[model samples]
Target: MEKRVVVTGIGAVSPVGNDVDAMWESVRAGKHGIAQITRFDLEGQKVTLAAEVKDFDFGDRRAAKRLDIADQYALVAAREAMADSGIVSGENVDPNRFGVYGGTGIGGLATLESEVSKCVKKNTPARASALLVPMMMPNAIAGNISMEFKAKGASFGIVSACAAGTHNIGEAYRNIKHGYNDVVIAGGAESVLAPISFSGFANMTAMNPTTDPDRASIPFDVDRNGFILGEGAGWLILEELEHAKARGAEILAEVVGYGATSDAYHITAPDPEGEGASRALEMAIEDAGIAPSDVDYINAHGTGTPYNDAFETIAIKKVFGDDTKVPVSSTKSMTGHLLGAAGGLEAVICVKALIEGFIPPTAGLQKQDPELDLDYVPIQGREADLKYVLSNSLGFGGHNAALIMKKYED
Candidate 1:
């Protein structure tokens, strides 16, 4: 028999708030986390804003020394999650059975930038620190997380662009369901609001370069222009149902289904027909042994880009049909696109919505787009007795993922 997985703990360091309770409060209130970019100088850049995690201090948790920002973000969330799950100590628990799955779309970009600047200006006199490579490595986030927590099973980073975070969580669910591990720490971490990342997105015209921060990242709206970049980390502790029960861990939600597909059409744009995204959603529903209408709330992959919003609307319509009556919204309107970290952050939002029985609103969506006619909880968040919510993410290279989280009953 296949094992069952339940989420026992969730920790997040998002643009809205740092801890799970604070972050969920902001998300439930439909607050936008977007603000001017302050991670680096934005003097004359076309895009001058992003959702940055403010005042996060991760001290001597990893090595009693310096660590990369992304790794630190992951470690911070991991620590909270372990504590929440009552698995902080591995004395009786088998460390070999604990696993860690962390991801980031563009890992260590900030650290890389800093080191490059150092190499050019100051490296003439001496060699850069040996820590540069480890600090700047993309996989360092996962490795460091595993080392910090001493997770002995399945420790690695799975980078699939914006889908990286969600994919990590989903993969962790799969591992636990396969009986490989009883507990898993999984999520995505990102800190890519650096100068080069901003400039590249701006040059590619992928970012919203408007002066009005409130109106930017308005998904499912005709006036929507582009996605606003954001930074943060999210971690969730997945434990076997029996394990959680034995430990008296609080169950947040149950991971019922996960599906992934490749659009195989565009490098940056989604298939106009949204065939892959639609298939991915349908597969997730099938995996959950549920029908289309069984899903009550849909946390859309609405990226605020013209192509993504339109295509995702079509995908939802294809899968849900008149079930379009279902409540759908993109929290990205508030949190901005955290890229690889988006899946993990949005997963938390979905889990919280399932537990709280309220669907968070897609803030900043003032005007509705004609092409994308879906029941978007625009501007104001709504209260609903939601049981299952589908969280979706479509990333570059046509990666599409869908996860279904159901309210825990037993």
Candidate 2:
């Protein structure tokens, strides 16, 4: 028989707030985190806004100076999660049975850019620091997290763009269900709020042009333009049912099922038909052995982009049918787009919604897009007795991932 997996702890370092409670409160209150970019000079950039982690002091200046922002975010969030789970040493849980699975879209881009600038100014490759390569690598966050926690089993990173965080949690769930590990620290982190990163996205016309934080990421609204880039990290502690019970851990929510698919049509754009996304939803529902109607709420991958919002609506309709009145919302309206960390943060929101009995709303949604009509819990959150919720994350590389989380029960 396959084992079951449950979320015991969650940690977040997000634009809206530094910790999970503060972040969730901001999300629930419909507060927007996007603002004018201040990390670097934005003189010639068309897009000058982002949702950045504000007033974050990692406490240890030495570690802060040595590590990249993404790595620091991951480590901080992981430390919080580890503390919340109360699994510090090998007394209750074996070190070999613990694992780490992290994800990121563009890891340490700021570090790479800084090192390159130094090399160019000094006119020599030797000017770059020896740690430059490791710092810039996408897997460095996971490597550092594993070493920090002493997780000796199945330590690695997932790099599926925006779907990365969901993929990490999904894969970690599978690992525990199959008895490969008893516990896993899984999530995604990203901090690419640099001039080069902004310029690239702006050049592609992928980011929102509006400077107003509240209106910038207006998903499901007819006036929606595009997503606002954001930075942060989200981590969760997932453990086997028996192991958690043996230790008397507080179960937050159960990860019931996961589904991943590829559009195989475009590199950056989703298939207009949303066939792949629909299939992923179907697969996740099937995997959970639950009917479509059973899912009470949906945390949409609503990027506020024209193509993404419409295509995601089509996919949701295809799976749950047009008549389904499932309340859907995009937390990105407040948190902006956390890239690889989007899925992880959204998953934490889903679990929180289950536990708190309330659904967060899409912050800036005013006039709903007529063509895409659904109960998109607009403008404000509402109290709901949610039993099961699904969170979707669609990435740039035709990657589509869905995770089903249900209220934990004995």
Candidate 3:
């Protein structure tokens, strides 16, 4: 028998704000977080704007120093989520049955860059730090989170480029739904706001080179060129439905469906036909056993890149019909592109929209591309009775993932 999974708690550390409430408030107001680079000097960098987390403090100096920046973000968000869920290991839930499924696009890149620079500049390969391997490993975030929370059931990180976060949540949902785990902490974190990261993205023309925060990440707009790099973390506590009810947990939403597919065509560019993405959306809708019309809202994976935005439109149309009336918007316009954390942050937005009966707009989306026609809810959010919402995430390396979240009703 397949069990049901529900999201009982959520947390976020984003550019718009440090915590979930602050981030959601800024999102609802359609305010952006992108700005000029501040983590490092941009004297000769082509890309000047990034969605960097501001005023972040992990509150524990010793612990913060031990973990990489990515791990720190994950730990902070996980702490909030664990507190919000009120689930104590060995008390309400078994520590052995608690799992941690985290994801990251480029984990601990800051540590990697730092260590590599030390070795290269000092003209000696032995100049690297002794703790470099553990700090910079891609799975370190998951390992750190699992150890912190004593989640011994399943602890691992999924690396699917930008789709990593959504994949983590999806896998966690499955882990609980199949009776493998009672509770799971699923999310993603990223903080590679270093100069090398920026240079690579800028050289590839993957990032918007603009300095204006408002216009840097304008999704679905005709003038949108590319995405701005954003760094932060978002987390959710997914529990077995029965376990949540037994503990009197406050359920925010239900994880009804998950769909994952690969483009198999390009490393960075999406398939022009959007066939793979379309199939993923179709699979998710079918998995939920719901009609396309049942979804009240869609949090699009509109990355603001010309190919991504246009092709995503086609994928949505493929699943929801050409004239579908479902309200669609890209919160990335405000949050920038969180890479692996994008799906996590967007999933948080979907849950909040479902709870508050509101739809956040695509900030700075003043004009929509005439070719792509849909109710984008541009510039300002509006109230809506949202029941079911879909969050889409399409990453580099042909990764495509979709999650269907239904508002909880007992």
Candidate 4:
């Protein structure tokens, strides 16, 4: 028999707010978190802004010193989620059945960049630290998280660029639904605000060129340009429904469906017709046994880039129809693009939206693009009795993933 999966706990370290409650509050008020870059000096940089996690404290200096910034963010968010779920590995749940599935787009870029720079500048290969491999590997996030929680079951990292987080959650959901695991810690983390990353993105014209924070990440707007890089982590504690109920856990929302597809057409740009994305959305709704019209809200993958927004609109129209009234919006307008962590954070937002019955708006989206017509819930959020929310995530290398979260009921 197929088991049901529910999200019992969520945690976030985002640009808008460090914790889930604070982040949701800021998102509800349609607040943008974009600002000038502070992680490094931008004296000679074209892109001068990013959505950085301000005033972050790891709370463990000794442990923080041994991990990369991305790992630190994951650990902190995981700690919060573990505590929120109140599931001790050995006491409430079987440590052997618990699992961790984490992801990152650019794993430990800061550590890798720093070590390589040191080696080149000193003209000695031995300048690299012995802990470089363990700290910088992409799987380190999952490994560290598993060790932290003593999860002995399936543990690994997925690196599908920006869709990595959603992939992580989707994989975890399936694992639990298939009865392979009773509990899973799943999400994504990213902290690559280093010099090399900035230069590469800027040169590729992926980062927003505008310096104004207000207009930096204006998704679906006619004036939209590109996305602002953001860093942080978002995590969810997913547990089997029966297992959760048996342990008296509070179920926040249920993971009803997940759909993932590959464009196979382009490496960076989405299919011009949005065939892949539309298929993913359709597959998700179908997987949930719900029609497209049944989706109460849609958390769009509106990266504010010209190609992404336009193509995503095409995909939504293809699946939901042209005159669809679904309240669609992009939280990226406020949180900026967390890249690999975008889906995880957006998943957290979707679960919260289902729980709170509030629809967040695409902040800073004033003039809508006439070409792309949809109710983007612009400028400000409003109250709504949301039943099911769908979150879309499109990544480079033509990856598209969609997740459906339904309101919990007895």
Candidate 5:
């Protein structure tokens, strides 16, 4: 029998707020989290702004001392999610049946940069800490989460650039649905607001150079520039539906379908025809056994970049037709682009929208792009009785992912 997968708990450590409730409230209000970059000196960088998690404290002295920023963010969010799901100490759940899957675009870049700089200054490799390799590996986030929660089942990392977060959660959904595991902790985290990362992105012209917070990330807007670097994490506790119900877990939403594809066109840019992204969307809708029109909302992979927004718009039109009026919005307009964490955070937002009956807006969208004609819930949120929501995440290397979520029924 095919098992059903459902989301029982969510946790977020974002730039807007440190916790899920606070972040959701800010998102609902269309608040912007972007501001001056504080992680490093931005004197020579073209992009001086970012959405950085402010005043973050893990509250565990050991974790604070040992973990990298991304690992710390992942651990904190995972802890909150596990607690919210009432899976205390693995008493009711088998630790081996639980799993961890995490994603990150540039895991522990800050730590790597620091260690390299120390080695350079000391003129010897001995200056680097013994923990540097484990701390900087992309898999560290998932490994640490698994160690923290004692999840012995299939713990691993997903590293598909910006699509990584969505891929992680999507893979976790599949794991539970196929009876591989009863519960999975899945999400993405990133903390690359350091000097090297900032300079690299700025020089590549991938980040918005605008300094104004409100104007920095206007996705799908006429004046859209580029994405704003954001640091944070989002985690969800996904479980088999029957297992969750048996434990009296408060089901948030159902994971209906997932689709992932590659453009094979450009390394850093989306396919001009948007074929890969369109196919992913079509596959997800088909996997969900629903027509495109049945989807009420879309959390777009709108990074506020010219190529990304335009290509994504073309992809949406291709999947749903040009005239289809499904309301779409990019929470990145407010939260900035969380990169690998974008899909994970957006997935949480989709589930929340299904539960809360309100669709968040693409904040700062004063004037719609004349080229793109779609109902992008602009400037403000709207009350909507959304049943099924789709979230997209397009990454570098042509990676595209789409996830379809439905309000839990019976």
Candidate 6:
């Protein structure tokens, strides 16, 4: 028999707000987090806007001078998530039964850039700042999170570019389900609003040209140019079913199934037909032991890119086929695209959907593209009774991940 995995808590330091309540309010109210670049100067970049985390102070979690922003963000969000799980002190919480798994697509880019500049001007590397490996390495999210909560069961990172968050959660779900650990801190964090990061994405033409935050990230819309780069950290606590019951933990949502696949075709683009993604979705449904018709809501990885929207729509249609049982909405339309943190943040949205039983609308969706014919809860958010929510995320480098979150009944 396999152990069941359930989400006990969620925390997010997103572009819009600091914690889950504020962030979800911003998302539910259709507040756009994208704005003119303020983290650094983006005067000449074609894309001068991003969905950046605002008003985030690392606080007592760590001294500002001691850690990189990426790791700080992870710790801050992890603090909230651990508290939400009702196990913050980590005392009496079995250290040997807890673990950490986190990721960041572009970890601590700002720190790396500053170090490089110092070396070039001074003709010698900064020995004091030499821990740049741990600062900028993608695994730093996991390392920092482990230190914050002293999770000692197991720890690692999943670097799947943009799909990192979802990948981390799915793999963490496996860790708990297979009895590798009873609890896992899983998610992704990112802080890549640097000159090189922005220019590299812009040069590839994968960024939204719209300067208006209100309309910048409109996935599946006819007028969408591309994704508006976004940044944040989202963390969730995945506790084993038996453990959660014993601890009297509040079950946010049950992670029923997780499916992942590789496009094997492109490092930057998905297959035109979305065949790889389509298969992943099907596998997820099967793993959940649910028919396609059982899924009620789909939180799509709609990145507002022409190819991503069209391809994702085709993939959704493939999973549901003629049934069309699920209503799809892309919260990225409001949060912009969080890259490595996309899946983690989206997973929080799904869990919230199951908790609140309301599906958030896809903001900025004024006119739909004919290519995306499925019913998108567009324009305004909706209040609905949700039973199961399938969250999907496809990353660059041909990585695709799907997770099914269902209302916990038992």
Top lDDT: which candidate number?
4
lDDT of 6 by residue, 1-410 (tens): 68999999899888878899998898888778888989887678889889888887877654666677878878888888998998653564688889998987777888888788778767776553857667878887898788778888888889999889999999999888998888999999888888888889999999987778877899889999999988888888999998899889999999999999999989899998898999889989998999988899999999999999999988888879844857899999888888888899899888888899789889889989976788889988888888889999999889999999899988
Deviating ranges (above 4 Å) for candidate 4: none
Counted clashes in each candidate structure: 0, 0, 0, 0, 0, 0
TM-score of each candidate structure, all chains considered together: 0.96, 0.99, 0.99, 0.99, 0.98, 0.97
Write one digit per residue (lDDT tens) for candidate 2, span 1-410. 89999999999999999989999999989998989988999899999889999999898998777789999989988888888888864777898999999999988999999998889977888888888988899999899999988888898889999999999999999999999999999999999998888888888888999877778999999999889999999999999999999999999999998999999999899999999999999989998999999999999999999999999999999999988899999999999999999998899899999999999999989999999899999999999999999999999889999999999999
Candidate 3 residues 258-316, lDDT tens each? 99999999999999999999888888888888999999999999989999999999999
The weakest ten consecutive residues by lDDT in model 2 span 84-93
lDDT of 4: 0.93
Clashing pairs in 5: none
Query: Between candidates 4 and 5, which one is better according to lDDT?
Result: 4
Range of the 10 consecutive residues with the lowest summed lDDT in candidate 3: 121-130
> What does candidate 1's lDDT look like per residue over 1-410, in tens digits?
78889998888888888888888888878788888887777787889889888888886655634677777778787777777778763863579999888888988888778778778767652556578788877788889888878888888888999999888988899999999998888889988888888889999889989878899889989898899998888888998999889877889899999999999998998899999999999989998999988899999888899988888888988988944698899999988998998998899888888888888998978899976777899988888988889999999999988999899988
Ranking by lDDT: 4, 2, 3, 5, 6, 1
Task: Report lDDT per candidate.
Answer: 0.86, 0.93, 0.91, 0.93, 0.91, 0.87
Name the lDDT value of residue 120 in candidate 6. Answer: 71
Off by over 4 Å in 2: none
Give one digit per residue, the lDDT tens place, for model 5 in 309-391: 99999999998998999999999998989998888888889989999999999999998999988999998999999999999
User: Residue 350's C-alpha lDDT in candidate 6?
Assistant: 87
- Candidate 6 backbone collisions, by pair: none
Worst 10-residue lDDT window for candidate 1 reads 121-130
Kindly list the per-residue Cα lDDT of model 4 for residues 176-206, writing each as its tens digit.
9999999999999998999899999999898
Q: Candidate 6: misplaced stretches above 4 Å?
A: 88-90, 126-128, 322-325
